[model samples]
Target chain A: MNRRLLLVSNSTLYGGGYLQHCQQNISDFFGKQVKRILFVPYALHDWDQYTKTARDKLNSLGYEVDSVHEAADPVKAVRKAEAIFIGGGNTFRLLKALYDNNLVTEIRKRVLQDGVPYMGSSAGTNVATVSINTTNDMPIIYPPSFSAIGLVPFNINPHYLDHDPNSRHMGETREQRITQYHEELNTPCVLGLREGSLLLVEGNTATLLGTTNARLFQRGKQTSEHEPGTDLSFLLTDAQ
Target chain B: MNRRLLLVSNSTLYGGGYLQHCQQNISDFFGKQVKRILFVPYALHDWDQYTKTARDKLNSLGYEVDSVHEAADPVKAVRKAEAIFIGGGNTFRLLKALYDNNLVTEIRKRVLQDGVPYMGSSAGTNVATVSINTTNDMPIIYPPSFSAIGLVPFNINPHYLDHDPNSRHMGETREQRITQYHEELNTPCVLGLREGSLLLVEGNTATLLGTTNARLFQRGKQTSEHEPGTDLSFLLTDAQ
Candidate 1:
């Protein structure tokens, strides 16, 4: 239970491709000795393929990747993992299975309580937030549960900027959306993050590591902007 | 043109409808001597229908409805109109044409400075805001321009709640969409008004009227709820 872990998202992967932010700075957190990697492929259509890819990534990093289809055995397999990386795909599906299987709580315990270094990518990143208010996916696929891993306190609006000013359709603008969140939520902070950006939290240090910009909005306050390479730990408290 | 005026929205009537909100509330604001009513179907698909409908509505209200398709015609049309109503439909399209034809500025002159009692609904309601961030349409159609007639501050998310909750689609929730707005603006309140609820600003006295619930969200603060059968004049900054 006392080890390092990584949680990567697979929401926006094309078809078959190499890992993304998962492998980006993962080693930096768990060190070069990560082993016994467990892959959560609930988001992909065929879990086998995503599991294979995840296995390859962990293998390249000198770790054994185990495909965990059953939730009851995640902690058992992960008890010895030097790091746990939950590969992402469709977030609603992944979170649903996690909620049903009761693995999310274990993952949370492994990372936060057990002091495992956890890294989550796209959908995996989404799982860390309080809710998915910032996701691009349709709310149509409402999961039985609304709570995520709750590692972070705000909602993540992923694929943050898809609005093209040239489109003829008149829909709600991005800013209007965050306002809608403010209407319903009094505490949950909605974080708008573009691709290639990661909000990393390490005990007392919350840092923004990536290549894109991060924006935060709350009711009654002007939006605060955070460029790449900004420390975000302070936001964890205010964001919650 | 210096005079009291009203603007009604017709974006909902599909093509242009013969009846508009302009004539419905004309005598109430213009007083018993409500002689001379003018209708502006600026949102019509064809300029002819817009023109023809205006003429008919004015004739019904015992006044003259003139066509303002020409560049300087709308300026002259509002000049002669004792009570003007801007009908709704596709606010983006309507306001874009008005701005292009240089009609928006003239309408503002007659309403804001001239003391026109501007009244609008749907898209009619949209143009009254500084921006149109509250529309429910998707981005299938984009308007050429985006500035409104500027009768009110903040954005109005009309038809505030989707009638059905069983259906699922991938767009911001009513509250989620509005929270997106708070991410960009803190002061310009986002008002989520149900169909019957309306915010009426008269000579600086803005009142909430109708038979439903309306929500007011201030950035940073949770959310303020208001119900129907209540006067919204207390929130007005410009006292009559």
Candidate 2:
């Protein structure tokens, strides 16, 4: 499998500037091999503002960023691009836009078969999984389907937070919701990636990168945490 | 327009017994008119356990409760039932089961036309709206569509909570998610009913019952709070 993917939990850390914390990782991932990047701003409500913000940030790193929406043919733009960057917003809207524009298969082919470097944050990272069933976003719009680009073997629960023991809120916690998900569909493992954490995949090797630990959830088993620098490439295998 | 519905935010309050707070309201709503109640336990992982729990609760209120699953013909049972109750669990599973059983139209006919009293807590309340797009539950399964029974003109967001001012979590708040839903589909108004809050609708009159304030969300407008005892019957009209 010729895959190079950077799946970030969030674009910005709490109280931090946009994409500021992951600038070094983004630079290292792209390097000199990637120059002009195709930006997918479909996840956001305001694509123009989102594209401008992303353009400004990536321009600071000496990379040219162009939004795919501006292209005459989105499929052509995706195929011709050296790299792809999907900014985070509402996952439902993002997936719907991808389906509406008929870009799911095109982007998947470019990333998996052509080895086009792919980077996504929050909702963007969500569509790289088997399904968006574990997404935290509200069902704002009815996408054609919950099926997403299978860039990774497992589902990603971005911006995953721990349950607050002292809180009085009666809603199901993130863990409870994921547990319910497992109860219903038990095969695919859920990766609860917290803010400031990301998964960097190069070929068959997938590395957990961040200062904090990422929680891994499996059916009928206790959840375990993994620290940064851990080799999680085994998750790429189907035998899990 | 001979509608009679009870849409509750949650089955139970925080640290409270199951369906304890709303027992009186339940009794008053059903009274002597509805003798046998059909319980929909599809939302729960353990249908048998949920049915048993609901039977015990409703039994104490002087009503004969039976689960729709145990019936030889589910649709016939729904038609023959004097009243219907839907328990809280995952909204996706509940909606999927309803669609699988082909009970969406049956339940709607009973509640909207036949004057069969309808009661739903959490996920159940979610299905009473035009669509399940505003639900707070995880999308564990994809239903046939986001469309629901349309017993109400708008949408219901059960177990709605306010954002914590001091929290450091980067995930979107309940209000933020609902606002995003409004951004994508602007027509429908979403009622954010807090725990212990419920909307009781009889014919054309819908009253807010309970001690808390329920938040109302409209597209491109400020979200306002409505206290219990307020007349919310205008929500039933299509002019909104």
Candidate 3:
């Protein structure tokens, strides 16, 4: 399991430009060895526009982008890609396209077996985990399955927000939703990745990144928060 | 179509008790003729507890509650139901239970063909429409399909909130999510029902009820807001 991943909580922070906050991290992850990235823009409605935004951002980090949608043979493109990146949008739409293009297996094999650098933000980050069950996005479209790339053993709730004491809204808070998920699924803990936070996965070890702390939820266990430098290697272990 | 529905945004408002805010509406919808209410408590984890809570509340409104979970045959329970009420929790779990128990067709038939009064809150209200695609609940469990009980022509987004301009949360606003839904699905406009709000449908006429206005999302059109007593009959038409 030589999987290397950079799962981002969001593409853009609240007051930052596109990929502005994570530019240094992105640059350091791919480094000088990786010059090109294969972008999956299916999560969004407009593939060309999503691809352009990603390409422009990655270009500034000294990397060229080739979108999977633009490729004649998406599977071949994935097989030959130096690195892979999935952008944020609707999770269901993204997963549906991945299944439609037959890129799930190819992407999984590339990321897990070939150790291709895999990066995703928001919807992208959600799909990299066990399933897209924890995503906050609407089910605008139905994918063949909720099963995602399984880049990680656990699930991730991207763009996780804390309940405001002053909020008048009565909808389920981020914590409550994750708890309900635990009621249904006993294994594979869920990580609530707050905005601006991310996880850097190298083989069996996953380290929290960014300034904010990440909250972890496991079945029948208390939820714990971890700081940026904390090693989340237990998540990658075959405990379940 | 001789269907009647009382789809509520939330069971309880921010500062209200369970089903407190909509008790009058519930009483009016059920009336003196409908005595026993067949309760579907599948949305929440503990069916017994959920059923008890609902029973206690509706009992005050002069209605007897018989939960489907306690029935010898669930489908028969729906068949003999004078009125149906599905309380809120998680949409995916509720839909999955409906599919698993083969109650979707039974409930739809009773509500549409038999004209048995139907009422749902939050997750429950979401499943009453074309599909649960616009629900705010997490997809903790995957149903066979996203296709829900088509009692109505459109979809309903329960517990809808207006995006707070002052909030720093970068997640997709309720409006943005519905807009994304429109991109993939052209028909069946989505109604964003705010807390303490509901839609009262009788035959071809659907009236907005409660204090707040409901937002309507149509494909290739600007989102519109409807006040209480507004006739949303256009939504029930076969124009889609």
Candidate 4:
């Protein structure tokens, strides 16, 4: 379990530039060992534009980036990639592309077995979990399955939001939606990672990184909040 | 095409009691023709409790409600049903039950061919569309497919909400999610039916019935808002 993963809740904060908030952490995680990275931009509809934007951001941080879509063989590209980065858009679309290209297993093998550094934001971070059941995105497209890379034990609910007491809207709050998921699946713990929050994993150790606290939900248990810098390595070994 | 349908955005309003706000509309739509109503409580986790609650509400309104779950043969029950009501809960669970019971075609045949009156709120309204692609509920469980009843030509996004200008959340807005859906599916129109709003359809005519304006989205066009009482019958003839 020498996997290195950086799962960010969001690529950009409100009123912030693209990937501006997590640029330093991205550089620190990959470090100088990783020079070239393969980018998975399938979650977005406009693949060229998404890849260009991500490539520019990574290039500014002294790393060369190439999109997997440009490769003649996606599976082969994943096997030979130095590091992997998956951008955020729609989770269903992202997973569909991964399955469509038969790159799901290859990427998992590289990241988990080969110990390749992996990074994802939003939809990208979503697939790093056991399943995409807790994602906030719409089912814009149907993926082959909801099962993801299973890089982590518990499910991750990225861009987690607290309910506004004054809202007049009748839609279910984020908490209620997650509770419904637990009703169907009582085993996997759901980690509600708010914007600006991320989970950094190395081997069996998982650490909460960001300014705000991350909320945790498990069946028949009270939701507990953990502050930044808290050691969450125990979650890595918890039941799926 | 003699079909009768009442698609409600939500069962409850912001500050109103459960099913209280739409009681008059429900009665006026059914009138004296409907006496015994077949209730589909499959969307709810607690079918017995949900059926009881709905039965109490309908009984107060001079209608006898019997849950489809109590029927020895669910498909046959749909064939002889005078009227049908599908309550709101998780859309995924509702669609799964419909598929598992092989009632999707039966209910559609009853409503479309037999002219049986049909009513649904939230998830129920969602399943009335060609597909449940625009629902606001979480996908706690996966159905056989995203394909739905297709009682209507287009899709329904119930509990549709407007973006909060003051919020800092990075999650995509409801409008954005629907827009992404259009990117994949360009034919079907999407109606964002807000709370306290509903659509009433009889034969080929569909009318907006509520106090608030409903939003409409079509591919290659700006989202348009239509006020209550507007004729939306054209939507019933559009592509699925």
- Distance (Å) between predicted and true CA of A122, model 2? 0.5
TM-score of each: 0.49, 0.98, 0.99, 0.98
TM-score of chain A of 3: 0.98
Q: What lDDT tens digits, residue by residue, belong to model 1 across residues A1-240?
A: 242323232323333345544455665766666656566776555778878877777677666767777445765755654456665555656776777676777877777677766666667777877755454432212355557787765666654554556533233556666654564435477677765556666765667666667778776678777897787766567444
Q: Note the Cα lDDT for every prediction shown.
A: 0.58, 0.91, 0.92, 0.91
What is the DockQ (computed on Cα atoms) for candidate 4? 0.82
Model 1 chain B: ten consecutive residues of lowest lDDT = B5-14
Question: Tens digit of lDDT per residue, candidate 3, span A100-205?
Answer: 9998888999999999999999999999999999999898888889999999889999998999999999998989998999998455799999998999999988
lDDT, residue A11, candidate 3: 93
Of candidates 4 and 1, the better by DockQ = 4
Q: Residue B182 of candidate 1: its Cα lDDT? A: 59
The sequence of per-residue lDDT tens digits that candidate 4 reaches over residues A101-130 is 998888889989999999999999999998
Question: Which residue runs of candidate 4 sit more than 4 Å off their true CA positions?
Answer: none
Candidate 1, residue B142: the lDDT equals 32
What DockQ results do all the predictions give, each relative to the true complex? 0.02, 0.82, 0.90, 0.82
Candidate 2, position B52, lDDT: 93
Give the 10-residue window scoring lowest on summed lDDT in candidate 4 chain A. A178-187
Per-residue lDDT for B154 in model 4?
95
DockQ of 2: 0.82
Docking class of 1: incorrect
In model 4, pairs of residues that clash are none
DockQ (model 3, Cα): 0.90
